[model samples]
Target: MFNQAESFPTLQVLLYQGLKKITVVEMLKTIGQDIGPSTRWTIRQDLARHSVKTLTSANAKEITAEGVIIDREGNEILIRGNTVVIATGTRAVNDLYERLKERVPEIFLIGDAKAPRKALEAVAEGLAVGRTV
Candidate 1:
């Protein structure tokens, strides 16, 4: 969505998040490179460069007839938009392995299949699986 926003000539992109800084889980660094630190700065700079407006410490409380009501620092802020995109994060479901394990001879649980993670970790797992295969 961030990449797509750049193509719009007159579009106003607003990103609202509950957290002040976007960060990756600390445990991710133990397996691979230290990408956690760079993510915050990189995202901040990229968003600014692309003219994307961001509201930190702001969470959507409700959607009324007027606009989206955001709770920011104990204050209510109304955000009006033609379109609303909600990104609530992701959860990993490893149930497939349980059901297929009885039928399948070989099973390789990798990436999100093992647990929820970033693209870098997913790609690393994919590469490792490919090499093993």
Candidate 2:
């Protein structure tokens, strides 16, 4: 996801975040591995730093990539590439087995989410089916 840059050990070049350089480790952690070297580093940095507040306008304008955009009064305009990925996942699809379940008669469900829990279950089910006939 990052563009290439000055690399180090155990890092993947993913995406470019504005002027700020982002690392692979940072990328994964941000997504949600929730664990890495900087995990400790972030904690240490947070402990070392102090918080403060800044004022802003009532309605903040949304920034976009296209068109010439600038900060404040179009002072020193910083051009940064921000990639936005929209993931609208639509996987409400059914499988062949599900279709069969809709048409078939005397459908028996078993273990692991309707799967056999143990080998014995399969054997017992087979035996019961056999006895039924």
**CA lDDT of every candidate:** 0.63, 0.39
Q: Candidate 1's residue-wise lDDT over 30-92, tens digit each?
A: 322334775767765665555556665666787777667877677888877545566555688
Q: What is the clash count for each candidate, in the order shown? A: 0, 8
Candidate 2 structure lDDT? 0.39
lDDT of 2 by residue, 1-133 (tens): 7767556532322221223332111112122223357676665444233221111111123346642233333343433336423322233233555768879776554332345245666677777777775
Q: What would you estimate as the lDDT of candidate 1?
A: 0.63
* Candidate 2 TM-score, C-alpha based: 0.23
Per-residue lDDT of 82 in model 2:
64
**Per-prediction TM-score, please?**
0.55, 0.23
